[model samples]
Target: MDNKTFSLQTDLALYCRTGLYEPQTSIQEHTFHYRRLVYNVIKDTLRRAFPMTRKLIGKRRWKKMVMHFFEYHKCQTPQVWKLPQEFSDYYQQVNFPFKKKFSFLVTLLQYEWLEIEVFMMEDLPIDEFSIEKKSQEDRIIPNPEIKILSTEYPVHLKNGKEITEEDKGQYFVSVHRDFYTKQIQFNDLSYPFVEIILKANEGCFSRKDFIELLAKYDSDREKIMKLYQDFEQFALQNTIFLGYQI
Candidate 1:
């Protein structure tokens, strides 16, 4: 076939596969059969990456949601690995009949996404761990990898069901590598400290200063030191304290 013939055929197949028919073609029978097969594979890939998000909405709604995205969104990356980040952005705009039925469900989906994203999103350069080499007087900036921080706007939940918010609270989440993957988890106090560290604000509170900042909350010196030690251990295990490039 000539170039023009080939181009016209490709365009017609694409348009027909997407449900917008071009002029009727003799080629339709074979191409349309393969089109359904390809589309189903693509949709299933999306569903797997976002299974929790799918379970949040039932199967039928989830399939419709994925189909809408596949039809509308022009995926920018040539690599399929990058698709989940795009899916996450799409996940935010979705509103099912009873979407917020589980108060922390959406947040949990986001949290799970971040855990996987951080571990795989980019490569951290390999480097020697050397925090032990720091002198007692050495002043150090807290490394970014030691902290996973974020804030949710205008909504708060307690016991996973009661939702209300007067103000946004900073969450200081911890991300650490366990075996081959990074894990994200946090307790109430640690979340705020992680947030402060990541903000890296000028005249911002130091990790040591974090204890002082929260002094009024619980003034037991032993407990405060224990918190610091635990976070330090987490940082060390994750290679953040040693300034491993990330």
Candidate 2:
């Protein structure tokens, strides 16, 4: 907080971020050496966080953004788990021209980062029930690691190099850490299925109940059976159902 401390920090930060610092004659060449080290560490961290975004933005612009982040964004959290989120937070308020040209960059970075985030999440146990539920009061608890995302760009599948405005669409997806394999998993989901999962987490609807609830609009048995089958396919994934509550 004092003038001397602030001046020292400001010089280091500027050198690391933009290579624009007054040469400290006291430290001599040692200052430049440390500056390079600091810059590379932060640059590598950003690269690891946003791999796809980095490739899309290319080397020049990606470095620039990272520098911008290093210069303007003061990271308060000491935990490394939060740095990527902080990087994304910096861009949330500042809409620069690159965003207009590459509208999918932020979404791509978010989607790419989510895989590692879920993989590192604390595991929650799920009870496996291979058979149909018999009671109306039984509840379905969604897997604690499951993250449901609705995005304008399909960042997971796309190559991230050639996305234009025409490639945009609403996508419903679920990403979870597999209970058995301990691997990150991804799946496509419909809006209805998402709604079912949300309501199930509240202990309101079982799969059978959801299908039957839809049956009210149309009494078609074939359609109801199809819906039931679809729900089964999704439920086959071990992470989808966290286990039923009595």
Candidate 3:
């Protein structure tokens, strides 16, 4: 496209996104209608993506926040569904009045966005591994689509408005899609379990490896064994460990 055509399109997009810089033409009235339609589409998409956030922030402030994001934040994603991820990123970085009051907002955005991410994630290639091999000596393979989120607030358990000073503590959550069912699942975990999953994500780990790793932290054999057993059950039940590598 020519410079003038490109410039015109850019201006229209800005107007649609921010309701600013209306093109000086006879079609200005039509452009206003088009802009409203564009804004509503984005608003609806965001509303669905973050229903809990909207409820906590209230309608008036949420609308203002959306307008602020629309006007100032230059969204990069062409996909409507993925736009919330960008918004989440933007919210975390930008300083907002609500952020001070709602300290857990960023974590909440991440928690909610993860559900969409896990559900829409592409199928991981597990052809090399065999689920039939379940042995302590064999290295366990984790689902490639899994994600672990560590936050200061228990956004997974409570809404933004519901959280208090008592709720401010370390929270670890594992969000993953079920390998067979294709359903998204969330699991609350302790710090040690999070560490184990992080290690597993780095590479395959066998039950023996986890036991040795735990031994480095604690010399008590019984404690290490119990912790390993708990993690083993959690991993297998959630499909965090898809299977043992062949």
**Rank by TM-score (best first):** 3, 2, 1
Q: Could you say which candidate leads in lDDT?
A: 3
Show the lowest summed lDDT stretch of 10 residues, model 1: 153-162
lDDT measured at residue 105 in model 2 versus the true structure, 0 to 100: 75
Taking the tens digit of each residue's C-alpha lDDT, what string does model 2 give over 165-201?
Answer: 7878888778888766878888877677777666665
Listed per candidate, the RMSD to the true structure in angstroms reads 5.9, 3.7, 2.1
Question: For residue 30, what is the lDDT in candidate 3?
Answer: 78
lDDT score for residue 25 of model 2 = 46
Candidate number that wins on TM-score, 2 or 3: 3
Candidate 2 wrong stretches, greater than 4 Å: 1-32, 125-141, 213-221, 242-246
TM-scores vs. true structure, each candidate: 0.62, 0.77, 0.90
lDDT-based ranking: 3, 2, 1
List candidate 3 stretches off by more than 4 Å. 24-29
Give a tens-digit lDDT track for model 1, residues 162-233. Answer: 344543455545544432245543433355445444543222233556556546556888887677667656
**Candidate 3 lDDT, tens digit per residue, 1-246?**
899888888888888886767876567667789778878888998999999999998998799888888878877888888988988998977887778888788888899999999899887676367767656688888877888899999888776677997888888999999987989989998877777888888887788888987887889999999989877877887888877788
Candidate 3 collision pairs? none
Worst-scoring 10-residue span by lDDT in model 3: 127-136
Which lDDT values do the candidates have, in the order given?
A: 0.54, 0.71, 0.84
Question: Candidate 1, 80: how far from true, in Å?
Answer: 1.4
Could you tell me which residue pairs clash in candidate 2?
Answer: none
